[model samples]
Target: MAELNINGNRRMLIGKVVSDKADKTIVVLVETLVKHPLYKKYIRRRTKFMAHDPANDCKIGDKVQIVEFRPLSRRKRWHLDKILEKAV
Candidate 1:
C-alpha cells in the first residue's frame, strides 16, 4: 500500500489524474510494485480511485495527492488534498 499516514492517521496517496470528466469528481490512477512470492519478480499493479474534487482543479495526467475521507458518495471515499504537479 502506498498510503501515507499523517495528520493523525489520515491516509494519503499520490497518484495521477486519469479522468476529470465527471462533475466534482476525478479518477486517479495509482501504481504499485509488488514482489512475487515464488518468482521474486516485481509486478506492477494499478488501482483506480474516485476522489472528490470539489474545486474541479484537476486535469488528466496531473499528479495529485489524495487523502482518505468519509464517504461522500457511493464510490467516493477520497478527497483531493493537493496537486503535486500539473500536466504540461
Candidate 2:
C-alpha cells in the first residue's frame, strides 16, 4: 500500500470580534452575501463563531483572523491566528 500523504487541516476566517467573554473565548461575526437566483439581489447574512484567544488580545470591534484547531471547549473549535486590522 502506498503511504497516504495527509494535508494539514485548517480554516481561516476574516471577521470582526463581536464579543470577548469567558476566559479565552471570543465571538467573531462574519458577514456574507447571498444572491437571489432569479432576481440576483444580494442579501446580507451574518454568522457568529466562538474562537479561542489564548492571549486575550482580541477586543470587540477589532478585525482578526481565526484558524481551526483541536476543540478547546464545547463551542470553541477555532483559535485566533492573528489580528489583521484594528477597528477605528
| Count of clashes, each model | 0, 0
| Candidate 1 Cα errors over 4 Å, as ranges | 1-3
Q: Cα lDDT of model 2 overall?
A: 0.80
Q: What is the TM-score of each candidate against the true structure?
A: 0.92, 0.82
Tell me how far candidate 1 lies from the true structure as C-alpha RMSD in angstroms: 1.8
| Candidate 1 per-residue lDDT over residues 1-88, each given as its tens digit | 3555577878889899999999999999998888999999999899999999999999999999999999999999999999989999
For candidate 2, write residues 11-32 as lDDT tens digits: 5777889899777889988777
Question: In candidate 2, which residue pairs get closer than 3 Å at backbone N, Cα or C atoms, i.e. clash?
Answer: none
Give candidate 2's error at residue 81 in angstroms: 0.7
Please identify model 2 stretches exceeding 4 Å from their true place.
Answer: 1-8
User: For this target, which candidate reaches the highest lDDT against the unseen true structure?
Assistant: 1
